[model samples]
Target: MNLQRTQTAQAPPAPRPGPVLAALAAAQFTVMLATSIVNVAIPQIRAGVGLSEGGTTWVVNAYGLAFGALLLAGGRAGDLLGRRRVLIAGLGLFAAASLGAGLAVSPETLIAARAAQGLGAATIAPAALALTMDLFPSGPRRGRALGVWGAVSAGGGAGGVLLGGALTQAWGWPWIFHSVAFGSVLVLVAVAALVPPSAGRAAGKFDLLGTATVTVALTCLVWGLTTARGTGWTDARVLGALLGAAVLLGAFVVIELRRPNALLPPQLFTTGRVAAGNLLMALLGSVWIGLFFFLPLYQQQVLGMGPLTTGVGQLPLAAANIIGASLAPRVSRRIGATATVSAALLTTAAGLLWLSRISADGSYLGQVLGPTALIGLGLSFAFFQLTALAVDGVPPQDTGLAGGLVNTTRQVGGAIGLAALATLAGSVTAHASTHRTHLEALTAGYRTAFMVCAATMAVAALLAVPLTRRKGRADGSRTPTAADPTTLPRQGRATRRTPAA
Candidate 1:
């Protein structure tokens, strides 16, 4: 009896889910907020730092390029090192970089700081997500936790626009960076205090060669796409960058296949619906990022709203996103994940179609609010479902890699989508400028981009059909595949089995 009592007393208590979830969610929110908070302050920042137009663009692109390119490395680092350790380090770096950005007086200084922020973000995102999965065992509770994760992440993107506008209008652009710096410090403290340490997975040496090739490949690809928006697709530099990215990517694949402990295991793609899920995620991300990009421009340029009003105007969409994310797990339980995603995509496509009809004289209430709300709801639903699907059936050891891959696809897709849509819109605007007024021509271009985004969503919806037959059981629940150890009864150690092809 004494031995039993002592054993019970020695057993560790389960972690408090609420505080852990909040800290992790806050970390994700801070990373995403930094992505868009600088947009509204670009004009002020350019003047403050004496930046040229190209330098102004770099201020935004530098962050994204670094963040997107280094995601895989960061994720792998979390797995090889420790998730909590990486998270703390990332937060420290992010806080310092935000402070540097706020204090920067030169174009070069600001851009470099922005790039450092991205690197920190890349480290934070995968580690935080992987830690979330680790702490929350797969079940209904995990589902709810993921719903909150999706909601806050979507909110951060929308909220950044609003917060950026308010901060810029009230206290100038530096305050945006200052605000992020403060938030990072708070989150870092919370994480350190509340989150428990997780041990690193036992693994072989880090895949330095695989990491380098893939990182440089992604950097070149993002740089090429971003540059194409300004210099056109046929430019020599753009072509060279794209070509270099392709070669590097090809080399990375070859190296991965040869390496015993690859940075990204090729076999993981064959697990469950991982490959298809990422493909769909890429498409969803393209539409998601494009909508946010074009919608704000429409509100400001076409409707003639100032930054503050435009920021306020996005509230409906943000509210709808919260609702949609809350509803996702419940809806997926009934209709199945694939069907839920398909329906969500169709809904978003319809919303985008409605947005395509906007005119220069359109009012915010009639033209923007309803459609944007619909799009926001559908986008949140699709993102929640797709994120689950992409990470489902992944092994415990590879969870960080799974997180990194999904994020990489989304970021890369956004870069490609934004560049293509911007170019297409520019061409349409140039053509319409021959006869239409300036506002009318700009409206025409925006309309064209919306139509294209709608079509893209529709295509993704159709592609979602195959996923149902592949991943679902006859009873409509996700099939308990061999790759997911959590699905097994906790009787003994679960054997790692390769999922069906």
Candidate 2:
């Protein structure tokens, strides 16, 4: 009886999917929230810190640049070192960076802090996602979990504007950073308690050369795109940065192909629709990121709304996003993943076309809310479907790599799209300003951007028809592989141990 009691007591408890999902979703939410929260607060931050226009731009760009550049390295580290350990370390660093940003009184300090926060975010995002994959085997359960993840992520992007406006109106801009800091701490504690430790999958030398070349290349690309929004694309510095990025990327590709232990294995792309999925993800992100940027500007600048009102105006979009994400798995099951994604993209394109009809004297209800709601719904559906496709059939050891690759594609695509769209809008506004009123000209520019975005989405929808059509369940379901927790050796326990660092 004593032996029986001891055996039962030593057995591990069954995993609780709810808390794990909540914690991971919360971490992603905080990362995306930080990306946009600062946008509404930019004017306030500038006034408080005596920032120049250029400095203010950096304050926004710094986080994205660092986050986009180091994602691959961070994801690889999580796979080789340990996902749980990397997550905790990332949360700690993110908390500290947020606190520093909150306390910063100088432009330099704030920018630096923001960059550090990006680094922490880079570490946290892939590790959190990889852990989610570990917890849920690929099937209906994983699909549902990813649906929640998609909902919170899209919500976070829109919610940041609302939360930032409310916080800035009530207390100040500093509280935005403080709120992130507090949230990170809470997530850190929850993850530490709820998540089981897993060992590193590989025991090999780190891919230092590939890491360096790719990181610098990504940094240059992001920097160039960001600069193109302020200084024209023809500027010398922008051209130089673009050239440098191109050269470095070639070197990185060569290194990856030759190295036995590549940071990004070439075979990963050959695995079940990964390449096509990432390509579609890039297209989706291009419009999704730029839509958020121009929509807020149209509300505040042309419609003459206050920060808080503009933020509140986004409620319809957020609601639609949640609803769409909730329905994505079911929709995919019913209609099929490829069909769902293609239809969603077409839906988004139609909404953008409607938005292109916005007038100088447009009302929020007619010109903004309806179209934005449609966009929110469609984009969420596409995002959820594409994310699942991107990671499908990935190997057990490379789960982190798959997660990182998908995210990197999205961010890079967003950066490029935002820069191009912003430039096109600015030029249109400038040209129209010569022949029209300021408000009319601004509206015209915004309208032009919407038209372009719609065209892009339409093209993406067409591309999706051919790209992801393969023999599988119409729902895109697959047999569980070694990547699934149930199929993993030692029941998903790590093969080797190492410090997170």
Candidate 3:
């Protein structure tokens, strides 16, 4: 008798997306809606909850603090644990937290619940992103999926600006949180029924020390900056917190560099794509945040519209953005990334420049509509491309870190932008000679802020130029074969040099 040997192998089946996508999109929209929806309800919440200035402001800040500070940790958890599992847990927690917040009778309770909601957001966002990548194998399919997803992420502020007013005026402050809570329940139901569980990271340890240090640093820095708004920049408390945060961040950098399993590996910065993407994200985030803060005042206080009307008025911007963000991929494929990104930034700058020309008598159609709509259009262009660039070329092993970095860019950028713009606007208002002059002065301040944003974003567009090649590159632009498991870690390491495509 002769012995026969046979060997057979089959490549794992290709991933297919289930109904989870629709549910995930809903969840993302709700999370983003939290930012804009709450702005219109601030005054009501303040009166109802007995919030002092800082305390009322903290209602918003608490959510941001938790989400921004803990995003890396949450993402790491999703990578190590199953993403579906994390998504479920996050949605459940978010619903509960939102319920608690909606029913809150006190500022303290509201702030606490808001923070919990943010933590939940941190969990859901990364898991959702990871799931999207896992589901789509890239190319045109992923691009379209990403275009829609990017709209949810990037165009959120405009939606918030419009929806917040309507919800707040029609339903009340609690309705904002209540709506999210209810929507979250629906998302959970959809996710549980439709999504398939995927394998988590094979073997990696969460960088607890690195996460802790970074968390403390971000929390401290954001806290100090926010406080510095009312208090002088030189206040002892602000100074101490800022200095402490700096030191902690320094320590964090040192710790991560040495650690075997750093949360955000230092080597990742070697990829130019990552660097450029994050930079642009931060700049655009700042502009987006500042827009919400000032526009309501501009429309309501300056233009003499009711809250509901103001919200309704912003619908044009939101509507335009939705259209623009959805079509961004088509634009990119035809024009190439550099031209698209630069055009967006320049358009945004021009819009702001137009806003600079606003007089006290400026009409919504004549002035506000043009500028805000352009802002919406420009932002969609920048945001979609920047998002594509951020996660581009990232190695599978570093997906968690890369996703976390993108979230971090947006959060930190918004924090910094809001702080800088609000402070400048306040200073300008103080210097105005008359009430009319004050609105004009504030508008003047906004003009300057917009110019700065435009300039910064232009530089950001330049950074993308080197990254944007005629054809998609490995890291900066997602292609069908870009997700090879073996190339993942290298993507992380080279992230800083990759630029964007």
Question: How many clashes in each candidate?
Answer: 0, 1, 19
TM-score of each: 0.91, 0.91, 0.87
Best of the candidates, lDDT: 2
Return the TM-score for candidate 2, rounded to 2 decimals.
0.91
Report every candidate's CA lDDT.
0.82, 0.83, 0.74
Tell me the lDDT of model 3 at 162.
73
TM-score, cand. 1 vs. native? 0.91
Q: Compared with the true structure, what per-residue lDDT tens digits does model 1 show for residues 284-307?
A: 777766676677778877787766
Q: After best superposition, candidate 1 residue 314: deviation in angstroms?
A: 1.1
Candidate 3 ranges beyond 4 A from true positions: 1-18, 433-451, 466-501
Worst 10 residues of 3 by lDDT: 1-10
Q: Global CA lDDT of candidate 2, please?
A: 0.83
Q: For residue 19, what is the lDDT in candidate 1?
A: 92
Better of 2 and 3 by TM-score: 2
Clashing pairs in 1: none
